[model samples]
Target: MTTAVSLQNVSKSYGEFKAVDSLSLDITSGCVFGLLGPNGAGKTTTIRMIVNITVPDSGSVYIFGEPASAKLRSKIGYLPEERGLYKKMKVREQLLFLAGLKGVDSKDSANRIVTWAERLKIAEWLDKKTEELSKGMQQKIQFIAALLHEPRLLILDEPFSGLDPVNTSLLMEVIRELSKSGVTIILSTHVMEQVEKLCDEICLINKSRKVLAGRLRDVKSNYGIRKLLIAFDGGDSFLKDDSLSVERFPEHYELNISSVEQAQQILRKAINAGAIIRKFELLEPSLHEIFVNKVTGVDG
Candidate 1:
Protein backbone atom coordinates (compact mmCIF):
# COMPACT_ATOMS: atom_id res chain seq x y z
CA MET A 1 0.00 0.00 0.00
CA THR A 2 1.15 3.54 -0.67
CA THR A 3 1.82 5.94 2.17
CA ALA A 4 -0.80 8.67 2.08
CA VAL A 5 0.85 10.86 4.68
CA SER A 6 4.24 10.80 6.43
CA LEU A 7 5.92 12.81 9.13
CA GLN A 8 9.58 12.56 10.04
CA ASN A 9 10.61 13.84 13.46
CA VAL A 10 8.08 16.67 13.19
CA SER A 11 8.16 19.14 16.04
CA LYS A 12 6.15 22.29 16.73
CA SER A 13 6.35 24.71 19.62
CA TYR A 14 4.63 27.86 20.91
CA GLY A 15 7.09 30.08 22.73
CA GLU A 16 8.23 28.10 25.81
CA PHE A 17 5.98 25.07 25.26
CA LYS A 18 6.47 22.29 22.74
CA ALA A 19 3.11 21.34 21.19
CA VAL A 20 4.45 18.37 19.23
CA ASP A 21 7.79 16.76 20.00
CA SER A 22 9.70 14.67 17.52
CA LEU A 23 6.55 13.03 16.14
CA SER A 24 6.62 10.55 13.28
CA LEU A 25 3.79 8.69 11.52
CA ASP A 26 3.02 6.89 8.24
CA ILE A 27 -0.65 6.68 7.23
CA THR A 28 -1.49 4.16 4.52
CA SER A 29 -3.55 5.11 1.51
CA GLY A 30 -7.27 4.17 1.48
CA CYS A 31 -7.26 3.33 5.17
CA VAL A 32 -9.16 4.86 8.07
CA PHE A 33 -6.44 6.03 10.44
CA GLY A 34 -7.34 7.21 13.93
CA LEU A 35 -5.35 10.12 15.35
CA LEU A 36 -6.17 9.84 19.06
CA GLY A 37 -5.14 11.69 22.18
CA PRO A 38 -6.47 13.42 25.28
CA ASN A 39 -7.11 17.15 25.34
CA GLY A 40 -4.08 19.42 24.72
CA ALA A 41 -2.02 16.40 23.56
CA GLY A 42 -1.17 18.22 20.28
CA LYS A 43 -3.48 16.23 18.05
CA THR A 44 -4.87 19.48 16.64
CA THR A 45 -1.39 20.98 16.27
CA THR A 46 -0.18 17.93 14.37
CA ILE A 47 -3.20 18.16 12.03
CA ARG A 48 -2.60 21.87 11.46
CA MET A 49 0.92 21.05 10.25
CA ILE A 50 -0.37 18.35 7.89
CA VAL A 51 -2.77 20.80 6.21
CA ASN A 52 -0.02 23.50 6.06
CA ILE A 53 -1.99 25.71 8.46
CA THR A 54 0.92 25.61 10.89
CA VAL A 55 4.52 24.92 10.01
CA PRO A 56 6.68 22.69 12.15
CA ASP A 57 9.77 24.21 13.70
CA SER A 58 11.83 21.18 12.64
CA GLY A 59 11.48 18.04 10.49
CA SER A 60 9.07 17.60 7.60
CA VAL A 61 5.57 16.56 6.52
CA TYR A 62 4.77 14.75 3.30
CA ILE A 63 1.39 14.23 1.66
CA PHE A 64 0.82 11.54 -0.95
CA GLY A 65 4.60 10.89 -1.02
CA GLU A 66 5.39 14.50 -1.98
CA PRO A 67 6.61 17.28 0.26
CA ALA A 68 3.66 19.21 1.67
CA SER A 69 2.78 22.21 -0.54
CA ALA A 70 -0.08 24.61 -1.23
CA LYS A 71 -0.92 22.87 -4.50
CA LEU A 72 -1.44 19.61 -2.60
CA ARG A 73 -4.11 21.24 -0.45
CA SER A 74 -6.57 20.68 -3.25
CA LYS A 75 -6.33 16.94 -2.68
CA ILE A 76 -7.09 17.24 1.02
CA GLY A 77 -10.44 17.98 2.72
CA TYR A 78 -10.25 19.14 6.31
CA LEU A 79 -13.18 19.51 8.74
CA PRO A 80 -11.52 21.31 11.62
CA GLU A 81 -12.58 20.86 15.26
CA GLU A 82 -13.67 24.46 15.38
CA ARG A 83 -16.53 24.71 12.93
CA GLY A 84 -16.11 27.51 10.33
CA LEU A 85 -19.12 28.63 8.34
CA TYR A 86 -20.83 31.90 7.45
CA LYS A 87 -23.80 32.04 9.79
CA LYS A 88 -25.59 34.67 7.73
CA MET A 89 -25.15 32.88 4.42
CA LYS A 90 -27.71 30.46 3.01
CA VAL A 91 -26.60 26.82 3.09
CA ARG A 92 -26.42 26.34 -0.67
CA GLU A 93 -24.57 29.59 -1.22
CA GLN A 94 -22.06 28.83 1.55
CA LEU A 95 -21.29 25.39 0.16
CA LEU A 96 -20.94 26.75 -3.35
CA PHE A 97 -18.56 29.49 -2.24
CA LEU A 98 -16.41 27.05 -0.25
CA ALA A 99 -16.32 24.56 -3.11
CA GLY A 100 -15.35 27.32 -5.52
CA LEU A 101 -12.38 28.10 -3.27
CA LYS A 102 -11.23 24.54 -3.89
CA GLY A 103 -11.45 25.29 -7.61
CA VAL A 104 -14.43 23.04 -8.15
CA ASP A 105 -16.48 24.13 -11.15
CA SER A 106 -19.73 25.84 -10.11
CA LYS A 107 -22.00 23.49 -12.04
CA ASP A 108 -20.20 20.40 -10.83
CA SER A 109 -20.00 21.74 -7.28
CA ALA A 110 -23.75 22.48 -7.22
CA ASN A 111 -24.56 18.96 -8.38
CA ARG A 112 -22.21 17.44 -5.88
CA ILE A 113 -23.72 19.56 -3.12
CA VAL A 114 -27.18 18.26 -3.92
CA THR A 115 -25.93 14.66 -3.96
CA TRP A 116 -24.23 14.94 -0.58
CA ALA A 117 -27.08 16.90 0.98
CA GLU A 118 -29.58 14.22 0.02
CA ARG A 119 -27.29 11.43 1.08
CA LEU A 120 -26.81 13.14 4.45
CA LYS A 121 -30.58 13.85 4.71
CA ILE A 122 -29.95 17.60 4.79
CA ALA A 123 -31.36 18.57 1.40
CA GLU A 124 -34.25 20.42 3.01
CA TRP A 125 -31.85 22.80 4.74
CA LEU A 126 -30.13 23.89 1.54
CA ASP A 127 -32.25 27.04 1.20
CA LYS A 128 -32.17 27.96 4.90
CA LYS A 129 -29.74 30.41 6.47
CA THR A 130 -26.87 28.63 8.24
CA GLU A 131 -27.73 30.30 11.58
CA GLU A 132 -31.29 28.93 11.52
CA LEU A 133 -30.03 25.34 11.72
CA SER A 134 -29.17 23.48 14.89
CA LYS A 135 -25.59 22.58 15.76
CA GLY A 136 -26.08 19.05 14.48
CA MET A 137 -27.52 20.37 11.23
CA GLN A 138 -24.63 22.80 10.81
CA GLN A 139 -22.19 19.97 11.40
CA LYS A 140 -23.78 18.00 8.59
CA ILE A 141 -23.50 21.01 6.28
CA GLN A 142 -19.81 21.44 7.13
CA PHE A 143 -19.31 17.76 6.42
CA ILE A 144 -20.91 18.22 3.01
CA ALA A 145 -18.70 21.23 2.30
CA ALA A 146 -15.65 19.05 2.93
CA LEU A 147 -16.86 16.48 0.41
CA LEU A 148 -17.97 18.88 -2.33
CA HIS A 149 -14.59 18.67 -4.06
CA GLU A 150 -14.30 14.88 -3.66
CA PRO A 151 -10.94 15.06 -1.91
CA ARG A 152 -8.64 12.07 -1.85
CA LEU A 153 -7.50 12.52 1.74
CA LEU A 154 -10.16 13.55 4.30
CA ILE A 155 -9.25 14.72 7.76
CA LEU A 156 -12.19 14.92 10.21
CA ASP A 157 -11.74 16.25 13.73
CA GLU A 158 -14.58 15.27 16.08
CA PRO A 159 -16.95 14.73 13.21
CA PHE A 160 -19.45 13.02 15.46
CA SER A 161 -19.68 15.84 17.93
CA GLY A 162 -23.18 17.41 18.37
CA LEU A 163 -24.78 14.53 16.49
CA ASP A 164 -27.41 12.36 18.09
CA PRO A 165 -27.04 8.58 18.10
CA VAL A 166 -29.02 8.19 14.89
CA ASN A 167 -27.05 10.86 13.07
CA THR A 168 -23.84 9.49 14.49
CA SER A 169 -24.60 6.07 13.05
CA LEU A 170 -25.48 7.68 9.74
CA LEU A 171 -22.16 9.53 9.64
CA MET A 172 -20.24 6.42 10.58
CA GLU A 173 -21.88 4.55 7.73
CA VAL A 174 -20.95 7.31 5.32
CA ILE A 175 -17.34 7.22 6.50
CA ARG A 176 -17.21 3.44 5.95
CA GLU A 177 -18.62 3.84 2.47
CA LEU A 178 -16.09 6.56 1.68
CA SER A 179 -13.24 4.34 2.88
CA LYS A 180 -14.53 1.49 0.69
CA SER A 181 -14.38 3.85 -2.27
CA GLY A 182 -10.61 4.25 -1.69
CA VAL A 183 -10.55 7.59 0.11
CA THR A 184 -7.89 7.89 2.81
CA ILE A 185 -9.24 9.32 6.06
CA ILE A 186 -7.55 10.61 9.18
CA LEU A 187 -10.13 10.56 12.03
CA SER A 188 -9.13 12.64 15.02
CA THR A 189 -11.51 12.33 17.95
CA HIS A 190 -11.57 11.55 21.64
CA VAL A 191 -14.42 9.05 21.23
CA MET A 192 -12.68 5.67 21.57
CA GLU A 193 -15.80 3.58 20.89
CA GLN A 194 -16.21 5.11 17.44
CA VAL A 195 -12.50 4.81 16.77
CA GLU A 196 -12.55 1.12 17.73
CA LYS A 197 -15.27 0.48 15.19
CA LEU A 198 -14.06 2.75 12.36
CA CYS A 199 -10.27 2.76 12.36
CA ASP A 200 -7.99 0.21 10.73
CA GLU A 201 -4.93 1.64 12.46
CA ILE A 202 -4.35 4.17 15.23
CA CYS A 203 -1.66 6.44 16.62
CA LEU A 204 -2.06 7.64 20.20
CA ILE A 205 -0.16 10.65 21.44
CA ASN A 206 0.20 12.16 24.91
CA LYS A 207 1.95 15.33 25.91
CA SER A 208 2.94 15.90 22.24
CA ARG A 209 4.63 12.50 21.86
CA LYS A 210 3.78 9.18 20.26
CA VAL A 211 2.77 6.63 22.87
CA LEU A 212 1.08 3.93 20.79
CA ALA A 213 0.75 3.28 17.07
CA GLY A 214 -0.20 0.07 15.21
CA ARG A 215 -2.92 -1.93 13.47
CA LEU A 216 -5.92 -1.94 15.83
CA ARG A 217 -6.12 -5.72 16.09
CA ASP A 218 -2.37 -6.09 16.57
CA VAL A 219 -2.28 -3.45 19.27
CA LYS A 220 -5.01 -5.21 21.22
CA SER A 221 -3.38 -8.64 20.77
CA ASN A 222 -0.07 -7.31 22.05
CA TYR A 223 -1.83 -6.22 25.22
CA GLY A 224 -3.29 -9.74 25.64
CA ILE A 225 -6.37 -10.66 27.70
CA ARG A 226 -6.04 -9.21 31.17
CA LYS A 227 -9.70 -8.88 32.11
CA LEU A 228 -12.72 -11.12 32.74
CA LEU A 229 -16.46 -10.51 32.83
CA ILE A 230 -18.84 -12.43 35.06
CA ALA A 231 -22.61 -12.21 35.32
CA PHE A 232 -24.13 -13.76 38.39
CA ASP A 233 -26.90 -13.50 40.95
CA GLY A 234 -26.04 -14.01 44.61
CA GLY A 235 -23.62 -12.95 47.30
CA ASP A 236 -21.08 -10.36 46.09
CA SER A 237 -18.39 -11.47 48.49
CA PHE A 238 -15.96 -12.50 45.76
CA LEU A 239 -15.92 -8.93 44.49
CA LYS A 240 -14.65 -7.74 47.84
CA ASP A 241 -11.50 -9.86 47.62
CA ASP A 242 -8.48 -7.61 48.11
CA SER A 243 -6.45 -9.71 45.68
CA LEU A 244 -8.86 -8.90 42.88
CA SER A 245 -9.42 -5.58 41.16
CA VAL A 246 -12.94 -5.19 39.79
CA GLU A 247 -15.38 -2.84 38.14
CA ARG A 248 -19.08 -3.23 38.82
CA PHE A 249 -21.42 -2.65 35.95
CA PRO A 250 -25.20 -2.92 35.93
CA GLU A 251 -25.25 -6.27 34.16
CA HIS A 252 -21.89 -7.78 35.02
CA TYR A 253 -18.64 -7.42 36.89
CA GLU A 254 -15.33 -6.90 35.13
CA LEU A 255 -12.36 -8.30 36.96
CA ASN A 256 -8.69 -7.79 36.17
CA ILE A 257 -6.86 -11.05 36.66
CA SER A 258 -3.41 -12.11 35.52
CA SER A 259 -3.99 -15.80 34.73
CA VAL A 260 -6.54 -18.51 34.04
CA GLU A 261 -5.79 -19.99 37.41
CA GLN A 262 -6.76 -16.79 39.14
CA ALA A 263 -10.02 -16.61 37.17
CA GLN A 264 -10.88 -20.22 38.08
CA GLN A 265 -10.21 -19.44 41.71
CA ILE A 266 -12.64 -16.52 41.55
CA LEU A 267 -15.30 -18.67 39.88
CA ARG A 268 -15.01 -21.29 42.62
CA LYS A 269 -15.28 -18.64 45.30
CA ALA A 270 -18.33 -17.10 43.65
CA ILE A 271 -20.11 -20.44 43.42
CA ASN A 272 -19.26 -21.32 47.01
CA ALA A 273 -20.82 -18.08 48.11
CA GLY A 274 -24.16 -19.24 46.58
CA ALA A 275 -23.76 -17.19 43.42
CA ILE A 276 -25.44 -18.55 40.32
CA ILE A 277 -23.09 -17.78 37.47
CA ARG A 278 -24.87 -16.96 34.20
CA LYS A 279 -21.91 -15.75 32.22
CA PHE A 280 -18.20 -15.92 32.72
CA GLU A 281 -15.70 -15.10 29.99
CA LEU A 282 -12.19 -13.84 29.65
CA LEU A 283 -12.11 -10.59 27.64
CA GLU A 284 -9.52 -8.63 25.75
CA PRO A 285 -8.86 -5.08 26.91
CA SER A 286 -11.13 -2.52 25.23
CA LEU A 287 -9.78 0.51 23.38
CA HIS A 288 -11.25 2.75 26.09
CA GLU A 289 -9.35 0.88 28.79
CA ILE A 290 -6.15 0.98 26.80
CA PHE A 291 -6.52 4.70 26.19
CA VAL A 292 -7.00 5.37 29.87
CA ASN A 293 -4.06 3.18 30.84
CA LYS A 294 -1.70 4.65 28.28
CA VAL A 295 -2.67 8.25 28.91
CA THR A 296 -2.36 7.89 32.67
CA GLY A 297 0.96 5.95 32.49
CA VAL A 298 -0.68 2.96 34.18
CA ASP A 299 0.39 0.55 31.46
CA GLY A 300 4.03 1.45 31.89
Candidate 2:
Protein backbone atom coordinates (compact mmCIF):
# COMPACT_ATOMS: atom_id res chain seq x y z
CA MET A 1 0.00 0.00 0.00
CA THR A 2 1.14 3.51 -0.70
CA THR A 3 1.84 6.06 2.02
CA ALA A 4 -1.01 8.53 1.88
CA VAL A 5 0.42 10.99 4.38
CA SER A 6 3.71 11.24 6.23
CA LEU A 7 5.16 13.60 8.82
CA GLN A 8 8.84 13.75 9.66
CA ASN A 9 9.69 15.45 12.96
CA VAL A 10 6.97 18.02 12.35
CA SER A 11 6.83 20.77 14.93
CA LYS A 12 4.61 23.82 15.24
CA SER A 13 4.73 26.67 17.73
CA TYR A 14 2.44 29.52 18.78
CA GLY A 15 4.47 32.29 20.38
CA GLU A 16 6.00 30.89 23.57
CA PHE A 17 4.20 27.53 23.41
CA LYS A 18 5.00 24.52 21.22
CA ALA A 19 1.76 23.07 19.86
CA VAL A 20 3.32 20.06 18.18
CA ASP A 21 6.75 18.80 19.17
CA SER A 22 8.82 16.60 16.91
CA LEU A 23 5.91 14.46 15.77
CA SER A 24 6.23 11.77 13.09
CA LEU A 25 3.80 9.22 11.67
CA ASP A 26 2.72 7.56 8.43
CA ILE A 27 -0.85 6.99 7.23
CA THR A 28 -1.38 4.30 4.64
CA SER A 29 -3.53 4.97 1.62
CA GLY A 30 -7.12 3.67 1.50
CA CYS A 31 -7.33 3.13 5.24
CA VAL A 32 -9.04 4.93 8.11
CA PHE A 33 -6.36 6.47 10.32
CA GLY A 34 -7.17 7.94 13.72
CA LEU A 35 -5.29 11.00 14.97
CA LEU A 36 -6.09 10.98 18.69
CA GLY A 37 -5.15 13.16 21.63
CA PRO A 38 -6.46 15.03 24.60
CA ASN A 39 -7.54 18.64 24.18
CA GLY A 40 -4.51 20.96 23.61
CA ALA A 41 -2.35 17.99 22.59
CA GLY A 42 -1.75 19.59 19.13
CA LYS A 43 -3.81 17.24 16.99
CA THR A 44 -5.36 20.23 15.25
CA THR A 45 -2.01 21.95 14.64
CA THR A 46 -0.52 18.82 13.10
CA ILE A 47 -3.57 18.52 10.86
CA ARG A 48 -3.25 22.15 9.80
CA MET A 49 0.38 21.64 8.83
CA ILE A 50 -0.55 18.59 6.72
CA VAL A 51 -3.15 20.60 4.80
CA ASN A 52 -0.72 23.56 4.52
CA ILE A 53 -3.15 25.78 6.42
CA THR A 54 -0.41 26.44 8.97
CA VAL A 55 3.24 26.01 8.07
CA PRO A 56 5.28 23.96 10.48
CA ASP A 57 8.18 25.65 12.16
CA SER A 58 10.39 22.65 11.43
CA GLY A 59 10.41 19.31 9.60
CA SER A 60 8.14 18.19 6.77
CA VAL A 61 4.72 16.89 5.74
CA TYR A 62 4.20 14.76 2.68
CA ILE A 63 0.88 14.00 1.00
CA PHE A 64 0.57 11.09 -1.39
CA GLY A 65 4.35 10.70 -1.55
CA GLU A 66 4.95 14.34 -2.56
CA PRO A 67 5.93 17.32 -0.43
CA ALA A 68 2.78 18.98 0.84
CA SER A 69 1.85 21.93 -1.38
CA ALA A 70 -1.06 24.16 -2.27
CA LYS A 71 -1.52 22.37 -5.57
CA LEU A 72 -2.28 19.21 -3.58
CA ARG A 73 -5.07 20.86 -1.64
CA SER A 74 -7.60 19.92 -4.28
CA LYS A 75 -6.91 16.26 -3.60
CA ILE A 76 -7.58 16.74 0.09
CA GLY A 77 -10.86 17.52 1.83
CA TYR A 78 -10.69 19.11 5.26
CA LEU A 79 -13.59 19.36 7.76
CA PRO A 80 -12.03 21.58 10.37
CA GLU A 81 -12.73 21.28 14.11
CA GLU A 82 -13.94 24.82 13.99
CA ARG A 83 -16.91 24.63 11.66
CA GLY A 84 -17.21 27.39 9.07
CA LEU A 85 -20.05 28.29 6.72
CA TYR A 86 -21.74 31.42 5.43
CA LYS A 87 -24.59 31.39 7.95
CA LYS A 88 -26.99 33.47 5.85
CA MET A 89 -26.47 31.46 2.66
CA LYS A 90 -28.87 28.74 1.60
CA VAL A 91 -27.49 25.21 1.96
CA ARG A 92 -27.42 24.45 -1.74
CA GLU A 93 -25.85 27.79 -2.66
CA GLN A 94 -23.23 27.48 0.11
CA LEU A 95 -22.21 24.01 -1.06
CA LEU A 96 -22.00 25.15 -4.65
CA PHE A 97 -19.80 28.09 -3.74
CA LEU A 98 -17.44 26.00 -1.64
CA ALA A 99 -17.16 23.37 -4.32
CA GLY A 100 -16.45 26.07 -6.91
CA LEU A 101 -13.54 27.22 -4.79
CA LYS A 102 -12.14 23.74 -5.31
CA GLY A 103 -12.60 24.18 -9.05
CA VAL A 104 -15.66 21.96 -9.24
CA ASP A 105 -18.05 22.97 -12.06
CA SER A 106 -21.16 24.72 -10.80
CA LYS A 107 -23.54 22.28 -12.52
CA ASP A 108 -21.63 19.22 -11.35
CA SER A 109 -21.44 20.65 -7.84
CA ALA A 110 -25.20 21.21 -7.84
CA ASN A 111 -25.89 17.63 -8.86
CA ARG A 112 -23.51 16.21 -6.26
CA ILE A 113 -24.87 18.47 -3.56
CA VAL A 114 -28.42 17.26 -4.16
CA THR A 115 -27.29 13.64 -4.26
CA TRP A 116 -25.36 13.94 -1.00
CA ALA A 117 -28.05 15.94 0.78
CA GLU A 118 -30.62 13.31 -0.12
CA ARG A 119 -28.35 10.53 1.03
CA LEU A 120 -27.67 12.35 4.29
CA LYS A 121 -31.43 12.92 4.73
CA ILE A 122 -31.16 16.67 4.38
CA ALA A 123 -32.54 17.10 0.88
CA GLU A 124 -35.39 19.33 2.03
CA TRP A 125 -32.96 21.65 3.79
CA LEU A 126 -31.06 22.56 0.63
CA ASP A 127 -32.94 25.83 0.33
CA LYS A 128 -32.88 26.54 4.06
CA LYS A 129 -30.48 29.16 5.35
CA THR A 130 -27.46 27.67 7.14
CA GLU A 131 -28.22 29.44 10.41
CA GLU A 132 -31.77 28.13 10.44
CA LEU A 133 -30.61 24.56 10.78
CA SER A 134 -29.78 22.95 14.09
CA LYS A 135 -26.14 22.38 14.97
CA GLY A 136 -26.31 18.74 13.90
CA MET A 137 -27.97 19.70 10.64
CA GLN A 138 -25.35 22.39 10.04
CA GLN A 139 -22.66 19.80 10.67
CA LYS A 140 -24.20 17.63 8.00
CA ILE A 141 -24.06 20.56 5.61
CA GLN A 142 -20.37 21.09 6.38
CA PHE A 143 -19.77 17.40 5.80
CA ILE A 144 -21.49 17.53 2.45
CA ALA A 145 -19.43 20.55 1.50
CA ALA A 146 -16.27 18.64 2.30
CA LEU A 147 -17.35 15.75 0.08
CA LEU A 148 -18.42 17.91 -2.86
CA HIS A 149 -14.96 17.79 -4.44
CA GLU A 150 -14.63 14.01 -4.12
CA PRO A 151 -11.24 14.38 -2.47
CA ARG A 152 -8.88 11.42 -2.36
CA LEU A 153 -7.82 12.29 1.17
CA LEU A 154 -10.57 13.26 3.60
CA ILE A 155 -9.47 14.78 6.87
CA LEU A 156 -12.32 14.92 9.42
CA ASP A 157 -11.75 16.76 12.67
CA GLU A 158 -14.49 15.99 15.21
CA PRO A 159 -16.88 15.21 12.41
CA PHE A 160 -19.37 13.75 14.88
CA SER A 161 -19.10 16.53 17.44
CA GLY A 162 -22.61 17.93 17.31
CA LEU A 163 -24.44 14.92 15.95
CA ASP A 164 -27.01 12.82 17.73
CA PRO A 165 -26.65 9.03 17.76
CA VAL A 166 -28.71 8.59 14.61
CA ASN A 167 -26.75 11.20 12.71
CA THR A 168 -23.49 9.91 14.05
CA SER A 169 -24.28 6.43 12.77
CA LEU A 170 -25.34 7.88 9.44
CA LEU A 171 -21.99 9.67 9.10
CA MET A 172 -20.03 6.61 10.16
CA GLU A 173 -21.75 4.59 7.46
CA VAL A 174 -20.76 7.19 4.88
CA ILE A 175 -17.15 7.16 6.09
CA ARG A 176 -17.01 3.39 5.73
CA GLU A 177 -18.39 3.67 2.23
CA LEU A 178 -15.77 6.27 1.31
CA SER A 179 -12.97 4.14 2.73
CA LYS A 180 -14.22 1.17 0.74
CA SER A 181 -14.04 3.23 -2.45
CA GLY A 182 -10.30 3.82 -1.84
CA VAL A 183 -10.39 7.26 -0.21
CA THR A 184 -7.79 7.64 2.51
CA ILE A 185 -9.43 9.07 5.63
CA ILE A 186 -7.77 10.80 8.55
CA LEU A 187 -10.23 10.85 11.47
CA SER A 188 -9.31 13.19 14.31
CA THR A 189 -11.55 12.98 17.35
CA HIS A 190 -11.55 12.39 21.09
CA VAL A 191 -14.09 9.59 20.79
CA MET A 192 -12.11 6.39 21.34
CA GLU A 193 -15.09 4.09 20.70
CA GLN A 194 -15.57 5.49 17.24
CA VAL A 195 -11.85 5.14 16.54
CA GLU A 196 -11.88 1.55 17.83
CA LYS A 197 -14.73 0.82 15.45
CA LEU A 198 -13.56 2.70 12.35
CA CYS A 199 -9.79 3.07 12.36
CA ASP A 200 -7.39 0.59 10.85
CA GLU A 201 -4.50 2.36 12.54
CA ILE A 202 -4.04 5.09 15.14
CA CYS A 203 -1.52 7.59 16.47
CA LEU A 204 -2.08 8.85 19.99
CA ILE A 205 -0.39 12.04 21.09
CA ASN A 206 -0.11 13.76 24.44
CA LYS A 207 1.73 16.85 25.60
CA SER A 208 2.78 17.54 21.98
CA ARG A 209 4.54 14.17 21.66
CA LYS A 210 3.77 10.84 20.05
CA VAL A 211 2.79 8.44 22.81
CA LEU A 212 1.53 5.52 20.75
CA ALA A 213 1.35 4.70 17.03
CA GLY A 214 0.56 1.41 15.29
CA ARG A 215 -2.09 -0.82 13.76
CA LEU A 216 -5.12 -0.94 16.08
CA ARG A 217 -4.93 -4.70 16.62
CA ASP A 218 -1.19 -4.67 17.21
CA VAL A 219 -1.44 -1.85 19.72
CA LYS A 220 -4.12 -3.70 21.68
CA SER A 221 -2.27 -7.01 21.45
CA ASN A 222 0.89 -5.39 22.76
CA TYR A 223 -1.04 -4.28 25.81
CA GLY A 224 -2.19 -7.89 26.33
CA ILE A 225 -5.38 -9.23 27.99
CA ARG A 226 -4.82 -8.55 31.65
CA LYS A 227 -8.28 -7.31 32.47
CA LEU A 228 -11.18 -9.50 33.53
CA LEU A 229 -14.79 -8.40 33.38
CA ILE A 230 -17.21 -10.09 35.74
CA ALA A 231 -20.77 -9.31 36.69
CA PHE A 232 -22.52 -10.96 39.57
CA ASP A 233 -25.33 -10.74 42.07
CA GLY A 234 -25.38 -11.54 45.81
CA GLY A 235 -22.37 -11.05 48.05
CA ASP A 236 -19.70 -8.50 47.12
CA SER A 237 -17.05 -10.10 49.32
CA PHE A 238 -14.92 -11.26 46.36
CA LEU A 239 -14.09 -7.61 45.57
CA LYS A 240 -12.60 -7.25 49.04
CA ASP A 241 -9.58 -9.30 48.04
CA ASP A 242 -6.49 -7.09 48.46
CA SER A 243 -4.63 -8.76 45.58
CA LEU A 244 -7.07 -7.42 43.03
CA SER A 245 -7.16 -3.88 41.66
CA VAL A 246 -10.67 -3.39 40.38
CA GLU A 247 -12.72 -0.75 38.67
CA ARG A 248 -16.39 -0.88 39.37
CA PHE A 249 -18.81 -0.15 36.60
CA PRO A 250 -22.54 0.09 37.10
CA GLU A 251 -23.23 -3.40 35.83
CA HIS A 252 -19.88 -5.13 36.13
CA TYR A 253 -16.48 -5.12 37.76
CA GLU A 254 -13.23 -4.98 35.80
CA LEU A 255 -10.33 -6.57 37.64
CA ASN A 256 -6.70 -6.33 36.68
CA ILE A 257 -5.31 -9.81 37.04
CA SER A 258 -1.91 -11.01 35.84
CA SER A 259 -2.69 -14.61 34.93
CA VAL A 260 -5.47 -16.97 33.97
CA GLU A 261 -4.91 -18.77 37.24
CA GLN A 262 -5.53 -15.56 39.10
CA ALA A 263 -8.71 -14.96 37.12
CA GLN A 264 -9.94 -18.46 37.91
CA GLN A 265 -9.09 -17.92 41.55
CA ILE A 266 -11.19 -14.78 41.57
CA LEU A 267 -14.13 -16.60 40.03
CA ARG A 268 -13.83 -19.38 42.58
CA LYS A 269 -13.72 -16.86 45.38
CA ALA A 270 -16.76 -15.09 44.02
CA ILE A 271 -18.63 -18.38 43.88
CA ASN A 272 -17.50 -19.34 47.38
CA ALA A 273 -18.71 -16.02 48.66
CA GLY A 274 -22.24 -16.89 47.49
CA ALA A 275 -22.08 -14.53 44.56
CA ILE A 276 -24.06 -15.67 41.53
CA ILE A 277 -21.94 -14.74 38.55
CA ARG A 278 -24.00 -13.38 35.66
CA LYS A 279 -21.10 -12.85 33.31
CA PHE A 280 -17.38 -13.47 33.39
CA GLU A 281 -14.80 -12.90 30.70
CA LEU A 282 -11.16 -12.13 30.31
CA LEU A 283 -10.52 -9.37 27.81
CA GLU A 284 -7.90 -7.01 26.59
CA PRO A 285 -8.17 -3.45 27.81
CA SER A 286 -10.59 -1.39 25.74
CA LEU A 287 -9.42 1.61 23.70
CA HIS A 288 -11.11 3.98 26.18
CA GLU A 289 -9.29 2.40 29.12
CA ILE A 290 -6.00 2.49 27.27
CA PHE A 291 -6.54 6.09 26.21
CA VAL A 292 -7.13 7.16 29.80
CA ASN A 293 -4.10 5.24 30.98
CA LYS A 294 -1.79 6.58 28.29
CA VAL A 295 -2.86 10.19 28.67
CA THR A 296 -2.57 10.05 32.44
CA GLY A 297 0.87 8.32 32.38
CA VAL A 298 -0.57 5.25 34.08
CA ASP A 299 0.01 2.77 31.24
CA GLY A 300 3.36 1.70 32.67
Assess the local accuracy of residue 242 in candidate 1 as a C-alpha lDDT between 0 and 100: 79
Q: Model 1, 27-87: lDDT tens per residue?
A: 9999999999999999999999999988899999999999998898889999999987899
Range of the 10 consecutive residues with the lowest summed lDDT in candidate 1 = 217-226
TM-score (all chains, Cα) for each model:
0.92, 0.92
**What's the distance in Å from true for residue 200, model 1?**
1.0
Candidate 2 lDDT over residue span 115-153, tens digit each: 999999999999989889998999999999889999999
Candidate lDDT values, in order: 0.94, 0.92
| TM-score between candidate 2 and the true structure | 0.92
Model 1 TM-score on a 0 to 1 scale: 0.92
Best by lDDT: 1
